[model samples]
Target: MSLTSEERAYIRSQSLARLATIGPNGPQVRPVGFVLNDDDTLDIGGPKLRESQKYRNARAHAEVALVIDDMAPADDPIAAGWGRGVEIRGRAELLTLDAPPMAPDFFSNDVIRVHPSRVISWHIAPEGQARDIV
Candidate 1:
């Protein structure tokens, strides 16, 4: 399902996002700090010039999955009761230092721009049904 503006906003407000990329060997996952830009693009900062496999994979495939969720502890039995999760599927573009209107400090290394193609979300429910917010 597509994501609503509000839902997307909520996802963006979260503290962290998990990035999934595919490499020649297999899938790679990394935790990243990010910012949701006003232009409806996700800005990911990390060093790209360095020999990072994830960046290399993104440069090659462009397709990526990003997941953001609220913190819920397993020890807290009630945690599951509070359902809050978001998933985004999109094409990732590497932002170079030469890119215009750059915010290099957003990431410590390099930055990746993700243009979402699909978004799905779920709010807490006792029945555990993940309904599409869009």
Candidate 2:
């Protein structure tokens, strides 16, 4: 399934995510600047993106996972227990970056495009209980 409207909104509100991919040394995860596409996909980019290990890993292993989340607000009623997040398991496509949503000066024209195969969101979770949004 694809991302729901709520999931898209949450992702749009955030700019960073943790991209995990398998590499020669096994699994590798790194912080990335992300852009939510109109097609329900995500573009991960950063400075020297083409030279990054995550980019190389995505080229070798097309499967990847992205975790985009934030701790609940300090005043949130469930701040001590619940949080908001989206975990996406998808296929990665190494491509040229286009119209990044983050700091344009810090990102190169390279991107790891993620096409979601599975989407799990906890943006509206009830105190530690995570559920699928799709």
**Best of the candidates, lDDT:** 2
How do the residues 7-125 of candidate 2 rate in per-residue lDDT, one tens digit apiece? 77778888789999999999998988888888988888888888989999999999999999898676665444457889999999988745545678777888888999888877444
User: In lDDT terms, how accurate is model 2?
Assistant: 0.82
Candidate 1 lDDT by residue in tens digits, 7-28: 6657656867889999998899
Model 1 stretches astray by more than 4 angstroms: 47-50, 72-80, 97-109, 124-134
Per-residue lDDT for 36 in model 1?
A: 75
How many clashes does the backbone of model 1 have? 6
Model 2, stretches more than 4 Å misplaced? 77-81, 98-101, 125-130
Q: Give the clashing residue pairs of candidate 2, or none.
A: none
TM-score for candidate 1: 0.71
In order, candidate lDDTs are 0.70, 0.82
lDDT of 1 at 15: 69
Worst 10 residues of 2 by lDDT: 125-134
